[model samples]
Target: MNNEQIMNLIQEISEVQAAGNYVSFTCNNFGIEVFVMRGEIKKSKEWDRTFFFRKMFSEKRTEEMYQECLEYLNKMKETV
Candidate 1:
């Protein structure tokens, strides 16, 4: 997906996370699961760093997404 699409997905995840809920979605060969645990947002590691990930998602984009998630997760944590 392009950066805009990825940002949209990130926004959706953030919304669900802020609401204290969980969401999972798959896009082409990529997928993500987001939820809260111990009052912090968390992402599932079910498909992280796997062969499929390397084949489907560019390392740069994947890291970008991860960093964005971390930023949002930390932002949420601070508000609690």
Candidate 2:
């Protein structure tokens, strides 16, 4: 999963293409979000920024969000 895969996943989520420093995908119900910020995952225990999160009504535990994160994170780690 490269940038292309991540970008495609983001599009699948129906995320709003808003202007911001970070690209965000939010699940309001679960209060979870996966975003790309400063070329890294936006949520890390070492460094986290969730100020822009908005609630999502979609039921989780589906392949949707997991695939997105897995692809993004896996590609990011591999590139490192």
Candidate 3:
């Protein structure tokens, strides 16, 4: 996606989160699942709004969570 499209997607995700909703998408090719949720960090007792991306096929996954998250959203947009 182009920069504008990417920014729009990011804005949409942020808006959804701000409205107390969870955002999730999946990438079939990589069997990756991405989730963005609002919560708190127990250790710091701070708000910890974040994204959790995981490879569905394996218990052990790589450190490419960011890439997987983007690819999942792109795939979702294509489907929509």
Candidate 4:
């Protein structure tokens, strides 16, 4: 995804979280699952065919999270 697309994804996720719901992002074989409520991340995970990783961000910042998502997406695209 491009910058605009990523930004839009972030916006959507934020909207979902604000509504007390969850959102997942997926492209090809890679996926990111996020659950945030009351400004706390209850669950966050990223996965691909080769690996599955989970993380909890106690001090998660939106910009940092989005940047990490972009990096992972870029890396996945490169490997494809």
Candidate 5:
């Protein structure tokens, strides 16, 4: 969506401008981003907050966990 359209879509949710490649928001308690390419939504992902820090935490931040979390979160979105 365009910026105005994007803002309307997120009216019920909180959207913040972060210095990065995607737009951020909250979904299923996981930080989510609206993936875009060439100024258009490509695919959105429900991020496990520490998405890029898995190597440092030694926690269960496996790919499987990420996929599972995304599956659950996407399902939540489909319902909306």
Candidate 6:
């Protein structure tokens, strides 16, 4: 999907996240349900600041799907 469409999806996910719940949606191209949950990453010794977390899930997880999810996350970060 294009950047605008991707951004829209990210926004929708963020809205659901803000409400303290997980959101699931099917990817039109992959026909797989993508689940998203929001939380915070614990601070580590190497990184003092705790980073925001966007946990993603799929029934048949693969590298390509992971990359796609990362793409969405990067886009979301950019918008933020």
| Cα RMSDs, all models | 11.0, 11.9, 10.6, 13.3, 14.4, 12.2
The per-model lDDT (C-alpha) reads: 0.51, 0.44, 0.47, 0.44, 0.35, 0.47
TM-score attained by model 3: 0.32
Pairwise lDDT winner, candidates 4 and 5: 4
TM-score, one value per model: 0.38, 0.34, 0.32, 0.33, 0.27, 0.32
> Whose lDDT is higher: candidate 4's or candidate 6's?
6
Model 1, 42: alpha-carbon shift in Å? 19
Q: Please, what are the lDDT tens digits per residue for candidate 4 over residues 17-60?
A: 45544345443334344433332334464323222222333334
Model with the higher TM-score, candidate 2 or 6: 2
lDDT of 6: 0.47
Ranking by TM-score: 1, 2, 4, 6, 3, 5
* Residue 74 local lDDT, model 2: 43
Clashing pairs in 6: none
lDDT at residue 46 of model 3 (Cα atoms): 37
- Residues 1-80 of candidate 3: C-alpha lDDT, one tens digit per residue: 23463455576665554555456544454443446544321344533233443345233333354555555444444443
Once fitted onto the true fold, the runs of candidate 4 whose alpha carbons sit more than 4 angstroms away are: 1-46, 49-60
Give the per-residue lDDT digits (tens) of candidate 5, residues 1-80: 22453354354222222212233443332333432211223446443232221333334554444455344434434443
- Alpha-carbon deviation at 39 in model 5, angstroms: 26
Worst 10 residues of 3 by lDDT: 40-49
| Candidate 4 global TM-score | 0.33
> What does the lDDT read for residue 79 in candidate 5?
45
Best by TM-score: 1
Ten contiguous residues with the weakest lDDT in model 6: 45-54
10 residues in a row with least lDDT, candidate 2: 45-54
